[model samples]
Target: MEMRAPEEIEIGQDITPPILPLAFTLSDSSLHSHCSSCFHPLNPKIPKPKPNNSHNPVPIPCNSHCNSSLLYCSHHCRHADADLHVSSGECHLFLQSDTSTWPSELSQLRLALRLFLCFQKLGFLSPEFLVSGRIGGLMSNREKFDIPGRIREGGRIMCLARRMRDGRFGNVVGESATDEMVLCLVLTNAVEVQVSEGRTIGVAVYGPGFSWFNHSCSPNASYRFSLTGFIGEPGSLEPGFRVTPCGEEGTFKAWNGDEDKLTNGSCKYGPKVMIRSIKSIKKGEEVCVAYADLLHPKMLRQSELWEKYRFVCCCDRCNSSPLTYVDRILQQNAANHSTCLDLDHSLCVEEAYRELTDCLDQAITEYMSSGNPESCCEMLEKMLIESSKTEQSQPLEPSPSNFKLHPLHHLSLNSYMTLASAYRIRALDSDSDKDNQLEAFELSRAGAAYSLLLAGATHHLFSSDSSLIAPAAHFWISAGESLMGLVKSSKWSSIIKKSSGFNLSSLLTQRSGKCLLLTELELGFVLRDGFDVVCKGFLACISRISPKVWPFLVHGLPYLKDINDPLDFSWLGMTARHEAQALIGGCECEGVAYIEEETIWKGLVLFALHCLLYGGYLTSVCYGPHCYLIGHVRNLLYGGEGSSLSENVENIC
Candidate 1:
């Protein structure tokens, strides 16, 4: 079965009405901070002794029976979900005498339990659905999986889930393989509900209208979650209008919108899903969404899809011969020439690449888990320096120093994001003593630079492929925020004061209103212009300003010192012609005409604002205006000369 557009769908238009899930569960990590029923952020601050990365959630009324059982943001949410929660037998997992001993991986088990109870209530266990391995309009993929570890885990969960009536409060859940089937279905169909970057709160499984949509590496549609009450978003498309399920002849039975009997069920505050077109879709054409991230290389994507969904992706992007330029850039060894990666790489290049990637990945992972910023900074910078080596005199033997990852390499992109975050954390951890103040200042500066470079590097790739717009939106907004933070730093106050002659008060005042409505900007970016047009204008404008400000952003950062131009990646070329590829020829700050510190910051202000504007435009397309992400971007771009970046910054973090 697949989903097809019922009418012509324009880019950025909603493809489906907000549809409720058949079952869902808040991830164990998210249970304490987000409402169990609705996934709403909770209330009251529980200040930690140490500085923390995530926002302090507001607390709300929690579970009464057992504090560890579930959390709800409001009485209505609890009221809405109580019956389903109680009957699903999940409440027993936390109410038992061994409540404190519940497995940390209880989320999947709980989700599967909910599916079992809900389907049972809907009388959806008929042999007809089971024979096809698709129950409740969702694929079980039961036959696709044969791994012993998974089979053992599923058996264990089935045993533990036996609850009341059958395995009730005093007893423990499997009956005639229902639990096994539902667990497999959960594994096959659940979509992670990610509300923010690097944050996935839970998982949800929707019905036919959503589940039938196929996978595409180059997808035309994208989906976002709306975690709201029984009443979904105001002005949301009503059901049965935008899309229709295209069930294959004699292969899968189409749902006759046959879920009427299940309509009276509860969980009023469950998350709703709506799919939108990232690319235009014509009536009767199939609409697809990416089942996995698109940025992964073809091999990684195929491996992941096979492991999880049991199918190899033959999407056009994955099947392209000679490989697409974007794919080439993502996996290329930049130290090598613009040569094809045939059956083999030079012994030196291949080994160096493997060692460096492993080393870089390990450093990044350690930093995230341990928050050891200084060590992370040291290790990543060393790897970056190693990766950028350009010497034909290089030894034929394998060595870390000989390996290279271009700025646009996916791994390099990961390092940039980690470094940007690590530097900010290092700044946050520094003391206020005068000796450390300068260090903190540089740390902040480095963070902002990494963020900007990330945006620029990704923007360069985005100029080639408009489909990268989602990630492009995120990077640009992040860069804008970092720059805004830098400009407001006390370290810049004295310099900026002296450069009052370089005031952007006019821009701040004139564009404040227009910032909120992207259509009003001079570029009229996302709304009034095609992506190709915006890409050209953005790249041209950013390039002209990069030389003046890039050095200032990368100052004191060794990893970034050699990057003469962040937005123009032509500088990243083969080892033999490295000198010829040197456009700025080392840092441009020393060679370019002298500009005042104040003028440099003025340039930063202009740079940051345009990035935010461009990011905001891209975001409007990727996440429609009603999304919280769009609201956050609007607030970031709403500032004027007198406004503080902090005022709106908190909304995102």
Candidate 2:
């Protein structure tokens, strides 16, 4: 089944209204931090770190008398979720001390329990939910994962929930067929509920309005979750969308629950998902959204989709004859001194595809689980530079002659993002020490360099694929943040003043013409210019300003010294399309040279403003101006961090 556009849809237009989840759950990790219902932060007073990583999942507990780890952010949230929580037997499942369940499975398990209870209450246990290969009109995909072990576990969990509710604990077998179906349905259709700031707090299973949209490598649509959204009317925003099952006309199915019962607001409190067109769509075109990370190469994307969704994506991007340019660059590796490792699909599988991802992931996970940023920085840098592969024969000394990752390789991108964050945290750890301020400033400088590199490299790829705009927006905003942060540092001003006879304070205090230039640019005008024009100007601006500060940005960072230019990815030399870049006199031959600190300050500031403006523009197109990234950008340009979006959105222009 797939959903088709009812009418021609322009970019950024909503394809679906804010659809409420039929069943939802928070993972065990966020149990204490976020609300069990709306998934809001439990304590706004605690400083939340600027969002960097995109997929951090956590757990939450319901606000009930049950002995569960679930917590609520507010009394209102708790009240709204009361019937769904306590009456659904979900409050009982969390009370179990089953430390044996894998953390990854905990979310689906809890959600399956919640969904089963709701299904029973709503009389959805009929063939519509149980016997058919569908649950509440969403594909169950039970056949793919209905192994005896999975079914047994599902039944065991189902019985456990019952036992917990009845104040008893025992190993007893019960009617588990329906429970297994619920688990399979959730595993098949649940989408992660990621917040505006890019944290995956929970999962939600929506009806056919969203679940019917099929998967694609280069999708025309994308979705976001709004926890504070009010579900006043179901299907009220029904546009011209219709669901077609197997290319045949089929009635668009919505949950037929009583309006009064639904409007009572028992199940409307969870995150509400809104689907928007990321690309222009024709009236009859089938709307598609990515089910897996689009940044992944074809092999990994296929692997992920098959593993999670039980199907291969036959999208044009996936079926490209010689592999898409983006896919080629993603898998390209530098072996034996800057030589591209050209591997076909067979070789990619044989190579185990980025054997270093496991090692790099371990280093990153260790840092995330523990609070040692310095160690993480050292470990990631060594892994990226050395590109080590551990052999069972010689685990310590002998080299296996492994290949280094291409800058745009998924692993390399992950490493750069982690390094940028780790370095930022390292700088913050020492920012309070007066004596170590210069060292901290250097760390900040390095962090900013990686952020710039990440943004430029990703944007360079975004030129080939418009679908990458979502992530490109994030990288650009993050880059502007790191750069502007360094430029605003008092320590930065002191160093520039002492070394180059200029105080950056004037730039801050004089209310410079730069502010006027930024505010004068309207968002509507930006979208009118189209992404291509904005991208062209953005790359040109970065190329012009970055050379002056590149050396200074990477002054003390050994890992970054090798890259000649961040934006000029002409090194790949994949296609002649780069001829357009010649108009800007591409910075491929940029020499590593630093000017005085004062000049560096000016260059960094100019570079940061361009990044922020361009980044904000792309973000508005992808996630809208009201996104959390816009607020961060707004706060940097004006000191209006916590102001309402309506009041401050105009300044974003």
- Can you give the TM-score per candidate against the true fold? 0.84, 0.83
RMSD of each: 6.8, 7.1
Worst 10 residues of 1 by lDDT: 576-585
TM-score, cand. 1 vs. native: 0.84
Clashes of 2: 9
lDDT of 1 by residue, 150-256 (tens): 64455455445454424534322234366677877887888888886537899877776677889988888888887655764475455443777667644344355
Task: Tell me the tens digit of each residue's lDDT in model 2 across 1-653.
Answer: 77777668888766665677788888767767777777776654544423552212333235476777676654455567766766666777667676255335677877887777767767778864455577556667778873658656765776678667767777657666777778778878889888756888888887666677898899888877776544664444433333233342222333443333322222666887767777888888888888998888888999998878888889999999877888877875543222334455336533644467777888889998998988998888887766622221222321134454656677888888999999999888778898888888889988999999999888877888888878888898899889878976776667555533332222333222223223223232244445465566456556766777888888767668777678776655564123234222232212323656655666676677668777887777776656667777777655553432223221111
TM-score of 2: 0.83
Q: What is the lDDT of residue 299 in candidate 2?
A: 86
Error of 1 at 494 (Å): 3.6
